[model samples]
Structures are given as C-alpha cells and as structure tokens.
Target chain A: MSFALQLFDLVGIFVFALSGGVLAVRQRLDLFGVLVLACATAVTGGIVRDVLIGAIPPASLADWRYLATAMFAGVVTFFRHGSIERMRNPVLMFDAAGLALYAVLGTGKALAFGLSPFAATLLGIITGIGGGIARDLLVARTPVVLQQTELYAVAALAGGGIVAIAHALGWPQAPAMAVGALLCFGLRFGAIRRGWRLPVARGTDSDS
Target chain B: MSFALQLFDLVGIFVFALSGGVLAVRQRLDLFGVLVLACATAVTGGIVRDVLIGAIPPASLADWRYLATAMFAGVVTFFRHGSIERMRNPVLMFDAAGLALYAVLGTGKALAFGLSPFAATLLGIITGIGGGIARDLLVARTPVVLQQTELYAVAALAGGGIVAIAHALGWPQAPAMAVGALLCFGLRFGAIRRGWRLPVARGTDSDS
Candidate 1:
C-alpha cells in the first residue's frame, strides 16, 4: 500500500477502536474487555481480508503500528467516553471514512491477488463491515449491517464496486480509490443526516 | 490431514452444526437463518485456525462436504426439532465429542505447521471454542466460553497441551492424540456429571 493509504488506514483503525471502546464502556465492560473489543473492532476487517487473500499473520499481527493505534484509541476512549459519546456525529463521520477506506482497499488487494471481480467486490464489502459486525457480536447485539433500516453495507458495496470496476478497466488506482472513498463517506453522511435507509422487509413472519 | 482425521473432523462438524441448528430453532430464526447459523458454527473454528496458520480459502470452504454436512444437519434439526430436543443428553455428549476432537486436531495441525508449543496449544483451544462462540454471538447471547466457572476452554486447553507436550517429547502422534481426546471428553463428561467448575473472581465491582 502507498504511504498515504497506509496512514489513512491507521486513522480509520483508531476511530473504529474509539467507537468500540465507547460501546464497551456503555456495556460496563472492564478495562480488559474494553481493550479487547476496541482492538478487535479495529483489526478484524483487515485481518479477515488479508486471510482471504492468503496474507499470512495479517497486518495487525505482523506490524505493531495497527495494534498500537487501536490500543491508544481504546485507552483514550475509556478515559473520555462521556465527552466522546456527546460528539456522536463526528465519531460516526470518522467511522464512515474508515469504512470507505477499508472497502476500497480490500477490493484493490483482492483484484491485485487475481481474484475475479465478483469475488473481489464481495470481499471488499466483507472488509468494510467485518469489524463492526465483530464488535456488535462481541457486545451481544445484532450487527447493524444486518439491520433492516441500516445503509452501512450498501455504502461499502458501492465503494468496493467502484474500486473493482476501476481495476477491471485498467484505470489509475489512486484516483479511483479516492473517488470511491468520497462516495462512500457521502452516502453515510446522507444516511445520518437525511435518514436514508434500505427498505424494510414486509413479509409475514409466519412464512419466514 | 489424514483420512481418518478428516472423517473424524466431518463427524465433529456435523454434531456442531446440529447444536447450532437447535439454538437457532430456539431463537425462532427462519430457515435461512438456521442454515446460516448451523454452517457458520460448524466451520468457524476450522476457518479461524486455518487463517491464523496461513491456510488460505480454508478447508471448510474448499471442501463441499463440510458445508453439505452442516446444511444437512440444519435441515434434519428443522424437521426433527421435537425429537432432537427430547434427546438433550445425547446432544450434549456429541457436542463434547466434537470439542475434544477439534482441540486435538487443531493442536496437531499447528504443531505440524511448525508453530511453537504455546501457540499451538492456544490455537487448539480457539479451534474447540470458536464455533460455539460464533453461534452464541449470532443469537445475541454472551458466549458460554466467557461465562464464569465454565470449564469448556480449560478442557480444550488440557487436550491441546497434551498434544503439544507429546510433540515436544518426540512421541508418536496417533496415540498421543487419542489419549488427549479421551482425556478432554472425560473431563467434559465428569464436569457435566459432577458440577465441576472453576473459581469465580470475588473482587468488588468498584475496583474492577
């Protein structure tokens, strides 16, 4: 990865960890639990993506930067949770940025590894949502990505699809990735501000 | 990776799937949800093990039989829910058998892959509990492995430790694996029969 993208990844991981730490505090998890949830939420997506593409040990385990960033975020949030929760909109925005970057990055990596477009796109979506799903599960909550009204995964899918399409067309990667991330961030921002959401299933529970 | 071990792995996966299916039914999940939970719970342990050990695509995803067995178990449980629920003790026993086998198998694989004994033993414990943890998390329940006084992981740890120790001593694997599995199964069985449990922390909530 380029230095710029790698830097973006650390920022994203830090924000993700902070959000997880906040949730852990709210759930009354002790310091150890908070750290676990924070670190897990920050790295699970990347680890899963790397594993799928045959990257051994994963970046989170192989390098100290990602884990240190997560731990730092966790500690900060643990100490300043009340203030952080009060700035929910900003946290969500940062989370959207992280999601966009992960989706784009995962897609690019998969394509570079010779995965087909369909598989690459799917893996990208997994990368974007994997961490949040893991964090929610650890807290015994239904993942927000699976919620009827959430638009999280769709935004990720769009970002991943963009990167995949760009790669398929032999387009310049850096610009395409930037555009994809912007689009994802925009979608998430719109969702938060305008209540944009997926249609809820209206089917009867008896049959399903 | 031998034929016998592969067959044993299939049996373990089948039993694990059945347990997950039962849980999904109790949760009132739909057919699709039941199948997903069943398959996920059956394969998660192996997948995590493979990913950690740099095994790509994972044997569970690579082999169609693993998925088919999980789906078949889910379907059987869906149709025979009442009968299966009636055989509670038998189901638990099967689950224990699965756990024992996974612990032994995971340790053996890790050791074969040139991991340190400590890491191998840790991976083995993860392999035994990973599926069940995923199953519980999916249903929005706290994982049983983290529950106070549950002896599940300790049992797997013991089993894994045995294999690790044996490998360290340059002993033949087959006999050591069999002994480890037996010891694990016995521990679980004894725990069930005699209320065996680990001690709980008695520290004040104010401090931790």
Candidate 2:
C-alpha cells in the first residue's frame, strides 16, 4: 500500500469521525450513540465502496487501521467536543478536504476494477458523500447532499473528474493525487464562498 | 405474486412511507424532503436487495406502484400529521408488520437465487431492517439494529430460517411465506411485549 494513500485515508476517516462526533454532541446523544454515529459516518462510505467494487470482507472489516482511527477520533471528540464545536468552520474545511481525498481515491479504485468512467464517477460521488448520507439518514433527515446550499457533492465530482483526467494523461500517481486533491478543495471552498449550487427544478420536469 | 402478498406489499410500503413522512414533519423538513425520505424508506431496501440479487434495474425502479404508494402515503401524512402522531402505536404496529412481510419476501427471493442459507438469512435481515437503518443514518442517528435492542435481528433470522426450512421440506410458496412472516412477527412482537433483551458485555474492552 502507498504510504501517502494510507495517510490520506487515515485523515479522511479521522475528519469524518470528528464531523460525526461534533454532530452527535450537538444532538445531545449519549456516549455509545455518539460513537455509533461517528463510526457510521467515518467508515460506511469506504465499506460500501469496497463492497460495490467486489472487494470481499470490506476494508472496514479486514484492516484494523480504519476502525481504530475512527474509534480514536470518536473518543478524542467525546472529550474535546466543546473545543471542537467552537472551531466548527475550520473543522468543516478539513472534512471537505477529506471528502475530496476520498472521492479521488474511490474513483481511482473503481476505475482500477475496470468499471466504466460513468460508473466510476458515480461510485466516487457515492464514496465521497455516502458517509454523510448515512449519518444524516440515521438521525432521520434528508441528506446534506440533497440540500440546495451544500456544495459537498460538487467537490466530489470535481475531484473525481480531475483524477480521471490525470489518469488519461498518464500522470504519475503522486502528481495525479495532488492535483485531484487540489481540484476537490478548490471547488469545494469556491462553492462555499460563492454560494454555488445545482438548480433544483421547482415547477417543471424539463428544467431538471 | 399472490394477490394477498401483493396487497400486503402495498400496505407495507404505505405504512413505511407514513412513518418516514411523520418523522420528516416532526423534524420540520420541507415537502420534497418528506417525500424523498418516505420513498427511500418505503422502497430503497427492496431496490437494493433486488440489485444485489442481480435482478436488473431493480423492482423499485421498475414498478410504478411502489413509488405511487409511498408518495401518496407521504402526501396523506403531510396533510394529517397531527392525527398520525396521535396514532403512533398503531403506526408502529403497522411498521412492524411491514418488517415481517418484507423480510420474508426478501428471504424467499434470496433462496430462489440459490444463495446459501446463511447468506439468504442475512439478505432477508438486510432487506427488512435496511430501510429503517438508511432512514436513521440519513438523520444522523445510530441505527436501532446496532444499538442494544430486543430481538430485531433475531426476528429477521426467524423469518429467514423459516423460509429456508420450508424450502428444505419441499413446501409450496404460499405456506412457506406465511410461516416466515408469522415467525418474524412472533419473535419481534414477543420481544417487544416481553421487553426481552440480549446482554451486552461490560467495558472489559474499552479499546473495542
């Protein structure tokens, strides 16, 4: 395994766990419930992605690293939730970066499995946003992805497409990953700053 | 499908949708959000179960009835939120029944597809519990299945095991399905009524 890739995965899981932990505290969930939500948000995406890619006994179950990282993050958040909540914006930015990293990684993995680009991109988005979706669904609400303001999905798409482009051009792995991450962060931050969004059709099916 | 089975399927879908809709309204979500949640809970499991079982395009995507039933239930719930909330117990009972019916149907489908008994039972549980899990996860809560609960998993197991046993005995479809459904409801309702619970290990492994 690439050390850099593994580092990115660890960071992604940690950040997502932090996000889930913050939300759990916000919702006033008990300790076990907090851990449960944190784990769900931190690991569900990669597990689903791996399963869909036909990686049996998903990475979440096979490798101890992801679970350990998520659990550690959850525990850390449990003790430092107040401080973490006060730094919400910065934490969200970190989460966005993690989302980008995961999106690129997921798409790359899907492509490696010989899926079509369309399917790969879809998997990338799913891998990127699925954790948050699962997190939201557990709490009984519409996912952040479907909301008008959240640029979460856009960031994933941009990062995934960039990875695909670099792959087409035969870029080295390091350069491709770096560019993909940059594109993802750039698009995500830009969307947040500029209020960019996909238009929801209001009155007509044709608009969609 | 047997007419009785088809009828129960429709009822189950509607009840599931109602539960979703009520929860959405309680959360102060918009109409579209309510509809999405309702539809997702009502059909996403069967859709996923079908796709995983290699039923191309999936039943949810193919059948308009499922969508219509869910959407209508959502609409009705939106307009009658107060009344529906007042009848929460009855609604829950319906939801439980839906769980039984869905589990049996899903198990039967898995068995027909030649999956092993273990796998079929798992698929049945997934099919039965999956929608609620998805719904809860979207709302950012830990799913009930993963939490300390009385016999939800066991209920799905019973239903699936019944189907497997009946298949092993060369029983016809209808009787097998009935047996499975009854087993599920019996286990689930019994647990609920008796407050039966499985013991959780104490914090011997804080690391776990």
Best by TM-score: 1
lDDT of 1 by residue, B96-158 (tens): 999999999999988887776766876798799899989998887877764544578778988
lDDT by residue (A48-123, candidate 1, tens digit) is 8888888776667556678779989988876777678789989999999999999999898899889998899999
lDDT of each prediction vs. the true structure?
Answer: 0.85, 0.78
**Candidate 2 falls in which docking quality class?**
incorrect
User: Candidate 2: misplaced stretches above 4 Å?
Assistant: A1-47, A50-208, B168-172, B204-208
Question: How many clashes (backbone N, Cα, C below 3 Å) per candidate?
Answer: 0, 22
Considering chain A alone, what is the TM-score of candidate 1?
Answer: 0.95
lDDT of 1 at A141: 82
Give the range where candidate 1 chain A is weakest over 10 consecutive residues by summed lDDT: A27-36
Worst 10 residues of 2 chain B by lDDT: B199-208
Model 2: fraction of native contacts: 0.16
| Quality of candidate 2 docking, DockQ | 0.11
